[model samples]
Target: MEANYVSKTAKSMQLHRRAKQVLPAGVSYFIRYFKPYPFYVDWAKGSKIRDVDGNVYTDYWMGHYTHILGHSPSRIVKAVKEQIEHGTHYGVCHELEIALAEQVVKMVPSAEMVRFSNSGTEAAMYATRLARSYTGKNKIVKFEGGWHGGYDALHLAVKPPFELLESNGITDGALRDTIVAPFNNLQETKKRINDKEIAAVIVEPVIGAGGCIPAEKEFLKGLRELCHEKDAVLIFDEIITGFRLAPGGGQQYYGVIPDITILGKILGGGFPIGGVTGRRDIMERMDPLLYERPKFSFQGGTFTANPATLTAGLEMLRNLEDGRVINNLNRHGRRVYRGLEAVFERKKVDAVVNCVGSLFQVHFTREKVRDVNAAYRADKEKLAKYHSALMDNSVFFLPAKNGAISSAHSEEDLEKLILETERFVGESGY
Candidate 1:
């Protein structure tokens, strides 16, 4: 048998065939591989997804850390459905927009005002512009593994193994204007500073895609102090962490506030939305009335602040009133983390896990994945084997180590993940 996933889904094969002929890389995203081909998803619901072949799985990818309250949550879905009935897009202001903005201000301690966009990239693109415009400076400093939504500057040296400096256009001067220091390297980050030319230091607080590594409290606090001392803005790109870590996201958890925060993912409850919000004075520039003309910031998209997204966002924000989502997520996350950790430890396997709040990553190294260097040092080959086996055993991850958590998952899901992982490690000869 060539795996149930491959043997079934005849229509999927045809669809992929047609898709590859027209679509770049056979899909819009690089992760949607068509070489070995990819499985098609029919639809999904709370805690479970059914692929084209009806392989029901307790999905943990959660739309790449986007679905905090779970897939098509009733509150979110109801909001969307009602809004959908009212002609999807309104290229103008709406009440939902105001509600969403107000909700963000109330929840995120750092955000006094929020301007919406359709994606985190846009939020980050504008955050960069705002940092430059506010400070009258041009340089942007980012951590080694911090991914701030894939514009030219922040995308550099993103996923390369720690030992290698693999990047493009991030030259010495490029890097000089855009400082790239190893995460958690307080001295290196300190050395990159001087007489206030660095416009901002942008980070994820807990770097999500970079193997779920959380900054040491000292490292984050140091960045805060250094940015303040250097007259630079400290920006937290909480696109993934916002509403996922806690009601206030990483800012509340870490207790180190940033000057500006870029948000996405959970804010829209799995819809395509993003926002950049901060101090009122800085955000007022986006107000057309202030300048007698509407000017575009990096976060501005034509679809930004439209009715449908605002509805979904407003509902999602409202759902956080109970604080139960974060609590459930953290509980499930801890269970999974501990279950996996115990398996590795009891078996004395050469593996490690990085966990914080409700997010985690299982690295196949005993060295501890504190930073990108250690994450790169982990046994990726074993991880691949483990990932494949877990899939075979009917659990779902991102098919990559860096993934998310959700309130929808249960301990049963964790057991499935752990048992499959242990079985793979013991049997796969790693």
Candidate 2:
């Protein structure tokens, strides 16, 4: 399989060789690096991406799950193009920012106010500061499998060996007040936070990077109640689940609202963006005029709230506001979940498929995956092989990462995915 991939991706291989001289690991992001080097995309449209080698594959990664409307949707492209002619970056306040923020407040149940940033990592960092400022506490609690971006306070305990630091540069003091708890197990989570001076409890409604496992509805309800009892802010890091789950995001879909919501990916309409939105009282801490320097939790960036990004974002939100597109995508997600499970079951493969709305990941294990530990215990090598097999057959999955379903994906595309999975199962001894 590796030899076959190398043969077909000669152009990509050559590009990778050149890239290694400039970019570390031949990729900008480490996650983009896969075995036998990753393919460099020449262009993408709708549900497919054409690599430099001219091999077109149905893309399930969807630009880190950002392109919910699929690549370069005509409406967003037109809006951005029109905005670009006016100005790309103002570095100052603009009506487009106000329009997008108002739209977010209208759609998100808890979003009484909104703030924007360039990426989810920046939003996570700012949100953490706001929570600490609002509550006057330093301690933050996060779930083991939850991923709230690369912010130091919430970056630990993301994967197995939960006690180890996720990265090297993080200082001990940076994580001193951050507590790690078990995901989906409210009792265990409560025990970890017992009687602590907590500022906030952050979580990913559906764990994305750690594993595509959905938090139990009951567990989320428990967290909401627990946060109230402890006077801690409840933040839902909805970077992966925000617009993709529903127009109102995971909070609306699960009927459990958080005090603050962190959003990214689909919110940008394929552009780079991150947002922090929630109750007005909590969000207002970022306002310098309302509070002095000591009380203020500052949040701003040079590229934040730029015209071009807001133009694209507003259009995307407007399309998803009615929930028709999101509902259809959810329906497709359910179908894919069932189809994939049936394929594995028919082949007597001991695999578990974890799915929530439009996001899904296949774990090569008999154990039911409820948390990150169970996910990592599965056959990692087998999962990689499965993803590679899918890629070879013109289906892309980013190799063991979660796969997303977009509105642009057709019935034929889904059918092809299932048939390819069946073929992979039949051919492989696993």
Best-performing candidate as measured by TM-score: 2
Stretches of candidate 1 exceeding 4 Å from the true structure: 1-4, 161-176, 194-196, 288-299
Q: Over the stretch 1-430, how does candidate 1's per-residue lDDT look in tens digits?
A: 1255576656677778888899976787765462246667898887788777777777777887777766778777887898899979978767888888889999999989988888998888888888877776888888887788766666665776533554545455544477777788889777765453788999888988779999888898998998888888999999988887889989988999999999998887788988999988777766666633324343466788878778888888888756787878888888878888888887888888888877888898878677877787787766666666676677777656565677667667777778887787678655
TM-score of 1: 0.93
Superposition error at 274 for model 2 (Å): 0.5
Give the 10-residue window scoring lowest on summed lDDT in candidate 1: 291-300
Model 2 agreement with the true structure over 270-347: per-residue lDDT tens digits:
889999999999998989899999999999988998888899999999999999999999999999999999999988
Worst 10 residues of 2 by lDDT: 145-154
lDDT of the structure predicted as candidate 1:
0.78
- lDDT of prediction 2: 0.92
The collision pairs in model 1 are none
lDDT of each: 0.78, 0.92
